[model samples]
Target: MDMSHIPDLITPAIPVFVITIIAEALWVKRQRAEAGVTLKGHTWKDTLASISMGLGSVAVGVGWKVVAFAGYAGLYHLTPLRMGSGPWAWVLLFFLEDLCYYAFHRVHHESRLFWASHVVHHSSQHYNLSTAVRQTWTPMTGWVFWVPLALLGFSPEMIVTQQAVSLLYQYWIHTEAIHRLPRPVEWLFNTPSHHRAHHASNAVYLDTNYAGILIIWDRLFGTFTPEVERPVYGLTKNLSTYNPVRIAFHEFAAIARDVARPGPLGQRLGYVFRNPAWKPKTAQAPEAPPPVEAAHPSP
Candidate 1:
């Protein structure tokens, strides 16, 4: 089936996103004011930086999507198996698509190469609705992760539609205002509380709660962690600049430098594929010289 007619799900929601951001910013401001707090949910400079990154992401993604959609469609045609677009099929696609996302999201955190792109969203020091828009400019390659869905007999439309849905569901969860919902709701879905832990750089929360729409995937896969307290948002070593280009490609450049360093092929590859925090092993520190001479002990 031709996937050209699949209306861009994200583009139409831009207005709603702008409105909701304004509303959430006001609410967060009022809440902090009433409580007499100094830190803000929406800072002028940070929000502007986030907006710049968001626009850059959209601009870059436009050209890339043409190639990506064609690839998805090409793969869909090769698969002999066909999944009909029925109500039950949509339900099945929901779980399958989210599971794909769970894998995509988790790997982006696990491997430094992918994390270079994924880290753009996590670059924010503040968790607000605007943070949701602070997407990666280098996300052109992310479509690779969802190619399996096309091969699994779903049309490009089905896969793209659900991917957009998962993304939309995640937007509201980026805020700090909602906190936890009812216990059952929190258990079933990816709540603000769970996502807060995901965004946190604290050691305990590192690499946890990687979810798109459902928290069940994280729980099932042993990556889930609850928000125990307020999270320290951003990377473990936060970026010092808000320049969109640096925010987008800093880690990629870091990987290049690490790979260029004098090392074995394996160690250099590790810099690309290993954890972002990974480093080559170093020699242990020499033990202090026998606690001085035996004559010194007598004194």
Candidate 2:
């Protein structure tokens, strides 16, 4: 586990961040304003949370690689997946990593244990390029979605490199700056149109479009929904507070609150691992709209 590659792994993300900021300033401003989407209330808080999560992610990647290398020491000496001269292997790794990401992402939405970490990314009401930087602070416990690659004997370096590329590719999809691409590109890739639907708070769009680089997984898995209308972006129950600490820990706090109520051990455990919007029998359900069309439509 050479820690040297960790820095290299994250360096590519810097340019993606730079390009996204430029795109936002030059293009997304009008779209955001036209859609009545403003980060004015949560910008600073989201920034802090994003920075915190970014730091934590670096640590997790490094630690995870160490464990991975140790686990496979006698079994296999992992090599970096390179795409320098001929890039077919690189391309294959990219798609493979994305395939894994689709699974990882879908489970994060469907399962409660993974949702605890993933919810931080979706907690922000305003969707923009910056929102893409708002990432998860914790290494999702019991949710090692990349294990399949390891089982197939892919080295830690290869896995990390592939993941970095997949993540870099996804950064561009975070913007409202880019609209529909030519014909089949929109149909194949995870375009801004598709991702906006994924971010929508609208019930029909909720928990759909979990693809990373490719939308085909969602299409195949039946999580796909075309962005036919404007998306109302935010959590079902909007967190009005701008405190990053509050935004990051709000769900955990709610889980704690639910667990404290009088109940059997099984019920308390169920409260922690059940679907995110789930409530105890004694708890009141939060009023929210049923599924409807997304607020932002494709042109």
- Which candidate achieves the best lDDT against the true structure? 1
RMSD for each model, in Å, please?
A: 3.1, 9.5
lDDT of 1 by residue, 201-263 (tens): 888899999888889988898989998866899888888997888998998999999899997
What is the TM-score of each predicted model, taking all chains together? 0.92, 0.78
lDDT of each: 0.86, 0.70
Q: Which ranges in model 2 have alpha carbons more than 4 Å from their true place?
A: 5-7, 29-92, 281-299
Judge candidate 2 against the unseen true structure and give its global Cα lDDT, from 0 to 1.
0.70
**Residue-level error in angstroms, candidate 1, position 123:** 0.7
Give the distance in Å from residue 19's predicted Cα in candidate 1 to where it truly belongs.
1.3
lDDT of 1 at 106: 89
lDDT of 2 by residue, 92-201 (tens): 66777788899999878876767877887887766666677666656544236776665555655566667767777777777665668876988899988899889888
